[model samples]
Each structure stands twice: as structure tokens, then as C-alpha cells.
Target: MAECNDLFLKFNDEIKLGSEKKKSLRKSRNAVGKDIQKYFDETLKVTKPKFWGQGSYMMNTIINPIEGEYDLDSGVYLMHLSDVEEEDWPATSTVHNWIKNAVKNRTSTPPQDKNTCIRVIYKDDYHVDLPIYIKNKDMEHPKLAHKSKGWIDSDPKELTKWFTDEVKEKSDQLKRIVRYFKAWKDFKANGDKFPSGMIFTILTANHYVEGYEENDDSAFVAVAKEIYDTLDENFSLDRPVFPKEELLEGWSETAKNNFLSKLSTLITNGQKALEEENKEEASKIWIKVFGDRLPKYTPPKEENRMDKGYALQTTEPPVLGNYGRSS
Candidate 1:
């Protein structure tokens, strides 16, 4: 069997958000936060909002997209004023409009007022999602301002904590496994109609296999097979925290079937790559699953191979450095 650990590590490096992009994303996030803060302080003159970094960005499982723009999710929290009663919090649409109006002109494109959050687009091909919420002392959890669904109990902080805690308990490889699955989704689905990053994160965390920390190829195959078998048996996933609601309950039949079919293909190709002996051939199989961003396999020099007895020795496991936030 071919040891493709080096190739997997290289793929991870290529797909992850680099330092420059992270810096740019941070600057964008900070600017948006300030823009929102200014609106509330100078215009709304209501309760000031608190900002919390959430989603894949905070959990550090986000990958650089293959085709579309990047995303950053920030939670905007509005504390209930002392004079206001718990039952008298602003309407969901009102709060969403407040956010929308706040960042209206921050970008050349007007802020998009969506059902769940307000989206601010930038010229750099990335956007920030500000999910508004109301926090009252009497309420157990913050309520999200959904345009259609109205105010609903939701807390992104809980979800972030859940993922970070799982990473702490499990191996850090779980994070990479999630990113690999996300990259597959981005490359194959090619749009937002597929399973979300949160869904992928939940599935990978639940099905991640231990003891393959040194071999990401084996680790990914094991996790993919586990998820495939489980979803095949019962097509459902629940949020690990908060509402604890079904994550895939809203997926259309076509979307679910398409995901399953693609996942099945990934498993077959992944197993084939593992069985292939030629390093370059194995990498080609991987390219079919991921895109051409994966590094091409290079042949060892004849002199170095002879001096190092490479023909008789086994392939070395790739040394993977820490790729994301340690937490």
C-alpha cells in the first residue's frame, strides 16, 4: 500500500487559509464590528451590541474555498435595557433592519438583509455574516432575530464551545478531517446547495477515528466510511448543543441523495488510492477527489535512493505541523 501521508499534509497546507488571508479577514471583521458599533452608538441610541466570533472561523476549521468567496460569521448581541421588560424586546425584523442600515454603505454593495443574518460583502471576495440576537436576563439563552421565523432561542457561543471542547478531548487531526471533508464539499458541490460547514464539522467530530494521527489518509478514509454507514442507516444529525435539533431535517431528498452518492465515490477513490503502490499514482487518485491544488508527487533521485537504500526502506510518515488555532 502506498503511504500518502506526505501528500495529504501538503494538500492540507494548500487548502488552509494562509497567514495573509487570515490577516485580511481579521481586518475586515474588525472594520465591520466597528461599523456596527458606530451605528448603534451614534444612530440607534439603543442598547449597545456585543460582538462574538463564531462558526468555522472561530473553531479554526475553515478552509480556503476553491471557487467562491470566503465567509466569516460574527454574532451581534443586544443586551436588554434596564428600562425594557423581557417581553418587550425589539422585534426580530426590527433588529435585523438596524444591522442592515448600520452597514448599508460600508461596502460598494449594499448589505444584504437575509432571514437569519445581515451579510456585508467586500471587494476582496469575502463577506461577513452578522447574526443578530437579543439577550435578556430572564431568558435562558439568547434569541436570534430571524426575519421569517421570528425571535428564536439560539446561542452560537455554545456551539463554538462544544467544537473547541471536542478538539481538546479528541486529537487535533479531527480538525484537519473536517477541513478535508469541507474541501470535498466545495469542490464537488460547487455551490451552497450542499451540506453546510457546520454539518460537516458535526459529522467529522462524531465519526472521527483515533490512532491514525500520523496517517491522515487512513484517518480520512475511516471517518468517511463511518459517516457513510451511519447516514445510510439513519439520515439524521442533531446539534451537539443548544436546540439539539436535527441538522439535516430540512435537506431536500435530491440534496441528500446527491451527497450520499458523492460520499460513496470519495470512499471508493480513497480506498483505491490507499491500495495503489506508486506514490504519483496515488496522488493522481487524490486529485480526482480534491482538485489540482494538491501537490504533484516527485520521484526520488537515483543517487540519493541508492545511498539511502530507499528501495528497501519504507516511506516516511509526513510530519504535520499545527495548522489552526491550538484551542
Candidate 2:
């Protein structure tokens, strides 16, 4: 029988970011950090322009993005912006535009003024989102600057910390499972079929049952079951870090159904994999669920017993003697 563990581990490696890319990403983010500091200190003359990483990178759930696209999110917390109100401590447009101008000339296209962040699109599959934030003394809490509504309470750092702590408390196994789910999200995001990364992350954390998963293969199986194991059709996901944060608040029903449909198919395939006698065949089933990144299934070599108590690998499945015909 082929080793299921080996297959999953190999698949995980194949789907994850490579060493060269990891180095490049780190370098790029470091340069970004410097750009933020330089623009604020010299150009804007603002003090203490600090930023922290959010999303998949901080959570260690980073995976290869679908197609040739990739993205990173960073929160820029500016402490000193002049002539701002107590209600609106940090001006959203001012900060967003500053970020926009900083990276505008650098990117292939002009920096976009998103709802909360200024997105810098790269030539290749790398883009970074710099969400403007404010930490006022009066508010005493980090508030994200929203273009439409002004300030809103959003702590990506808090969320990241919560996930990190949970992965620590339970096991690293959970984090790997999270990556697998994220990969599934990226894979199925052809159109409007897939849910947002935040939605999937919330659902996974909500439904994660720690002990059931021993490793990657079992973890995938466990998570597949856990998604459908819920009794309620209208399931609501709450952030583990911030219970008040509603993940699926305005998500469309069509999107939910699409996500669930894909997840259900994965679950059904996983069930079949568990029961199948041929290990190589089971891996093929998993490959269908995961996609082409998963390795092609190869059966174990048959060991042939010969003279002198020696063993040799046969080209085909080895045949054993001791045959009895019952008529």
C-alpha cells in the first residue's frame, strides 16, 4: 500500500510557497515597511508610523494563490496626524492617499483607493494592500479608517494573535488544516463560487475539532466532515479573536451554497478515500478534490521472494502461490 501520510505531506509542500519565493516576499515586505516609515517621517512629517502584518502570512496559513496571483495585507497605524478631530482622529483619505502616492509610481498600474486601503499591484502574482489605521489617545483603541463611514473598530493584530495562540494551545496540525482549506478556497475561486478568505478562515476556526486530526491526511478528512457536521443550514461564523466580529454578516446565499457544494464534494471524496483498499487509488481520489498540485498516484513496489532468502522488487504486483480452487 502507498503511504497516505507521505502523499499528503508531499502535497502540502507542493502547494506551499517555495523557499526562493519566501525570501523574495520577506524582502518585498521589508522594503514596504521602510517606504511607510520614510513617507510619514520625511514627506508627511508624521511621527510613529508603525505597521503590522495581517492575514495569511501572520497566521502562517500562506499558500500558493490560484493562478499566478498573490496578495499580502498590512495595517499602517499612524499615531500623529495633524488637524484631525476626536471623532475622526486619522483622516482616511489623507492616509490612504499618502499610501497611494507612495506606491503609485512603483506599480504597473496606478495605486487604487480601495474602501480602506491603497492597493499596489505588481507585474507578477504579487500585490500588497496597505490598510490605513489610527491609534488615538482619546479612543485608546486602534480604529481602521474607512472611506465611507470614517472610523471603525477592526483589529487584525488581535485576530492574528488569537489564531496564533489557538494553534499553539491545540497543535500546529490545526494551522496546516487551515492552509488546506485556504488552498481549497483559492482553487475554487474561479468566479463567484468561492467564499472570501476571511469567511473560510472563520468557518474553519469555528468548526475545527482538534484531536480528530492526527496529521495532514487525517486533518483534511476531519475538516471535510466537520464542515457538514453542523446541524444548522444557516450557520453563522464568529471570529474566535473577537466574538463581536460577524464574518458572514452580508454574504450572499448563492455564494454560501456554492462554497458548501464544493466542500460537500470534497467531503464525499474523502469518505471514499478512507474506505478504499487500494492506497494509490485513494490518493487519486484526494488529488481530484485538491487539484493538479497534488502528486500523481503511484502504487508500492511489489517485493518478490526468491532463493537464498532474498527479496527483489517486481515490475508488477507480485503473485503468491498457495492457491486452492473450490468447485
What TM-score does candidate 1 get on C-alpha atoms?
Answer: 0.90
Clashing pairs in model 2? Answer: none
- Residue-level error in angstroms, candidate 2, position 237: 1.0
C-alpha TM-scores of all predictions: 0.90, 0.86
lDDT of 2: 0.69
Q: What are the root-mean-square deviations of the candidates from the true structure over C-alphas?
A: 5.1, 5.9
Residue-wise C-alpha lDDT for candidate 1, range 1-327, written one tens digit per residue = 677787889889888888899999989989998888888888977667888999999998899987678999999988535345657776888888888998998899999999999999998889999998877666677778899989887989998899999999997888889999998887888653767899999999999877677889888988899999999888999999997788889877777788888899998898888777777888899988988887778776434234455555545445343221111
Model 2, span 1-327: residue lDDT tens: 223656677878877777788777777777777877887788888684777889887777788876766778888877674335656554677667777767766656887898978877777778788888776655545778788878788778878887777777777777777778777766666776565666666566766765444346656766666766561366566667643676666767776677677777777777676656576787788777778777766765667777788776577443222111100
Tell me how many residue pairs clash in candidate 2. Answer: 0
Q: Among these predicted structures, which one has the highest TM-score?
A: 1
